[model samples]
Target: MKERKIPEPKPLFIERMNRLIPDTNDQKNYWKIVKTEPVNTIRVNTMKINSEELIKKLEDYKWKLIQPWKNYPEILIVEGKTPSEREREILINKNLAKLEPGELGRTLEHLLGYYYIQELSSMLPIMALNPKENEIFLDLCASPGSKTTQAGNVMKNTGTIIANEVSLGRMRILASNLERCGITNTIITRKDGRSFCRKIKEQKIYFDKILVDAPCSGEGTLRSSPKTFLMWNPKTIKALSRLQKELLKSAFMTLKIGGEIVYSTCTHAPEENEGVINFILNEFKDKIEILDFELPLKTRPGLTQWEGKEYDSRVKKTKRVYPQDNNTEGFFLAKFRRLG
Candidate 1:
């Protein structure tokens, strides 16, 4: 028997990223992180168990739990590699928790819905939205339900959240995660997020807040999904940006006057981040405005000029999180408020 070797990601991916990232040191750091392993982190589902209680349970099981340095108190950084199959079985046999096969997901705690295995960066946009209890919310690109269930926890499962996804296959996963997380406030919808406005206007429905976790090239997630290195191209960024713009327009149209929308993506492409936001700012100058919010981790401001084209100055308020900054996946986030 032979041990399979992990293949090295293509250099072309890093070279292209270097050209796109403005800072020399940042570009170097980005490549460095992508080659390394992604962090093992998970969010404690407060809906099912509070952090203190969950921490006690995991600690009793001999698992080391540390809080992530970021402001999200509900999240805990797990130390130590995933246990072996025999060890996992022993833990389960002891009736401590249902032990799964992986580090975060296949755990007794996870099976009971005590925690959600999610990336650190994936939780940021929901933090920015700050969805409130009793308010109406929309997750425009929700699937696999990480953000959707996170929103439910934030709202204490008190508000109505429309979780929409265009793909039926993904919608099934989204529905399953929501059910597993014990999220009852969400109403799942199968519709193209780009046409959300037309679909919901018949009821004169509007949301108090929205989240557009737009689909992108997955550049930031190379550490976990190495195939992104082989598959990413400028054309992917361009096509996703066009779709993102339409989705943003739909989200804005369905949002109440005072409602806020948090736009985010896991890729480092400016075309999908600042470029799309800038284009919308120009087209809906009077209808929307960018809102600044803070994250505890270090982040870069959105680019003003990319490839000789200038973006709206307000786009500077937008944030870009890099793996080097926090040992997490790179992400772009911008908050916008409907003015009209």
Candidate 2:
């Protein structure tokens, strides 16, 4: 048996990105930065433990931990490799500990849900949403439950959260993570996000804040999931953009007047980012306004022009984080508030 080799990005995909980002030195730096692996990052589950205690525990293992974001001490970039076999054997022999997988998740802390392993940029959408206590919230495409869990944490289990996933297989994982994180404030639902939002809106259930983390081609996640390149297709991008626009549309309709909605995706495709936002801006016109938010990491404004197609100037309020921008996965986030 032979190990399969990973595939590289399609030439068309690379060409598209080059044109989209079209700066000579930036293109060089982007290529260089994206080739390297992202450092392991974990967000300490504050529902279970304090950041200081978790930092102390991990540092005892000689892990050099760095919290890269301001005022967010729970986000830790773990440096140094996991314990080697020799070191594990010594600990097991001396402390009567059992042999275990030498990975970050194999620790007692993780097993107890003291922290969650998530990509750095993956955390941005929740931050952009700025979840609050006692607010009705919905994670439109919640699965694997990272953002859902973060939203629950921010609300401190005070609000009702609807965590919806279309896939039965993914729902199980979402449920498990929610339970693992001890989040009791969420209601898990299985339905297509667009239909689910519509169904709830029909019942007169309006959310105070909503997060439509629309699915996309995942072009920005090449650093974490290189297989994304193999799955990348121009046709797929177009299909996803359609679904994204619908999802955002449904979420906006379900949001109460003066409520906020955040649209985010883990792809650099302008079709999925500014394009989708543009659709909503036109669809709702004066009823929706883009809200600008700042981040602690490096990010660029959303493009106003792509391939000579112009988007609403307000789309520039959207934020784009490239892999090289924060040494994290590529991500796009835009915030909106419903107006009467």
Q: How close is every model to the real structure, measured as TM-score?
A: 0.90, 0.92
Query: Residue-wise lDDT of candidate 2 within 159-269, one digit each (tens)?
Result: 899999999999999999999999999999999998998899889999999999888898888766778878899999999999999999998999999999999999999
Q: Give lDDT per model, in order.
A: 0.85, 0.87
Distance from true location, Cα of 181 in model 1, Å: 0.8
Best candidate according to TM-score: 2
Writing each residue's lDDT as its tens digit, candidate 1 over 1-340 gives: 1112335656765666777775998777766667777766889999998898998888765665789764677998776534556666765334223233375676688899999989989989998889999999999999989999999999999979999999999999999899989999999999888776677966799999999999999888877787876787777788998999998887888899989999999988889999999988998889898999988788889989787889988889999998888988889999999999
lDDT for position 273 in model 2: 94
lDDT of 1: 0.85
Predicted candidate 1, C-alpha RMSD:
5.0
Candidate 2: where are CA atoms >4 Å away?
1-6, 81-102
